[model samples]
Target: DVKVTQSSRYLVKRTGEKVFLECVQDMDHENMFWYRQDPGLGLRLIYFSYDVKMKEKGDIPEGYSVSREKKERFSLILESASTNQTSMYLCASTSGTATANTGELFFGEGSRLTVL
Candidate 1:
């Protein structure tokens, strides 16, 4: 089974401090993504890496960045945590298949962040 594990399930940060959230997938998926979930706003993509050492900016890349040094691991970095940045962070991964039925990605439990 495809499994995605997040480094933290909860986080609390002071405003302006940088934060790192890690994610690892057991499957050798080619696509890894970082996103933040907010009430009524749904999920917004932060960043995505298609392969090792390759990355792309998603819809909302401001105040955030990502790293993919290895095939199995992806990390999300918050440049400066703020009250507005406090939300549920999610990590997901998808296989390298080009089939249209690749379906949705597998998600982590989520990292809930609260900024003070």
Candidate 2:
């Protein structure tokens, strides 16, 4: 069984503060992704890393960045937090490239961020 664990399930930060969201995958998945979930917008990809020490900007990468130092861990960094950035962040991982890199994604519970 595969499991994705988020370091923090909930977080509250003030504007202009630096926020770090960490994720870990038990399975040796080659790919990891960070996504932000909002009411109407659905899941918007923030960033993704296909390999360690490599990252690719996703749909919404304006106020976000990612780091993949090791194969099992990926971290999302918010350089300057803002109210507009408050949302539920999800971390997902896939074992391998199953049909165009769209394998069965195992997701974490989610980290709900509220920027005040």
Candidate 3:
């Protein structure tokens, strides 16, 4: 089974602090994604990397960034944590477009961030 492991299940940060959320997948998937899920907005993509050292911005990439130096690992960085960025963050990965790019996304349990 493809498993995505997120570093934290919950976190608390102050405004302007830099935050890092790590994700690791054992499946060696080519595509990995970072997303933030909110109450009514559903899941909004923050960033995604299709290959090592390659990155792409998603719909809402304002306060977020990603790094994928290795096939099995990816990290999301918050340049400056803020109250508005508080939300449930999810990390996911797929075997790339061939498997099912638009299929159900395999998500981590999610990391809840609270900024004050």
Candidate 4:
């Protein structure tokens, strides 16, 4: 079965601290994405990658960065965390296969980060 695992289900950090959120997929999907879910904003994309070593900024890329060094793993980096950055972060992936017309995404449980 395909699975996406997030490194943490809950996290807490203080202001000006660095945070790392990791996600891994066993399905070997070609596309991976990072999103933050807030009460009003819904799911907002923070970053995404189509292949290993390649990344693109999403809707809200400020205060965030990404790394895709391997095919199965992706990491989101917060250089200096702040209260504004606290939220539920999600990691997802897609097969990107030609035969699969559905742009379905497999998602991890999610990691909630709290900044004080």
lDDT of each: 0.92, 0.94, 0.90, 0.95
- How does each model score on TM-score? 0.93, 0.95, 0.93, 0.94
User: Which candidate's lDDT is highest?
Assistant: 4
Better of 3 and 4 by lDDT: 4
- Location of the lowest summed lDDT over 10 successive residues in candidate 1: 95-104
Instruction: For residue 114, give model 2's deviation from the true position in Å.
Output: 0.2
The sequence of per-residue lDDT tens digits that candidate 1 reaches over residues 22-105 is 999998898999999999999999899889999999999999988999999999998888899989999999987456685579
RMSD of each: 1.4, 1.3, 1.6, 1.7
Query: How many residue pairs collide in each prediction?
Result: 0, 0, 0, 0
Instruction: Give the per-residue lDDT digits (tens) of candidate 3, residues 15-97.
Output: 99999999998887888999999999999999998899999999999988888999989999999999999999999987766
Where model 3 places Cα greater than 4 Å from the true spot, the runs are 97-104
TM-score of 4: 0.94
Runs of candidate 2 exceeding 4 Å displacement: 97-101
Q: Which candidate order results from sorting by lDDT in descending order?
A: 4, 2, 1, 3
Question: What is the TM-score of candidate 2?
Answer: 0.95
The residue-by-residue lDDT of candidate 2 on 7-79, one tens digit each, is 9999999999999999999999999999999999999999999899999999999999899999999999999
Q: What is the TM-score (0 to 1) of candidate 3?
A: 0.93
Question: 1-116, model 4: which lDDT tens digit per residue?
Answer: 88999999999999999999999999989999999999988999999998999999999999999999999999999999999999999999998845547588899999999999
RMSD of 2: 1.3
TM-score leaderboard ranking: 2, 4, 1, 3
Screening candidate 4 with a backbone cut-off below 3 angstroms (N, C-alpha, C), the clashing residue pairs are none
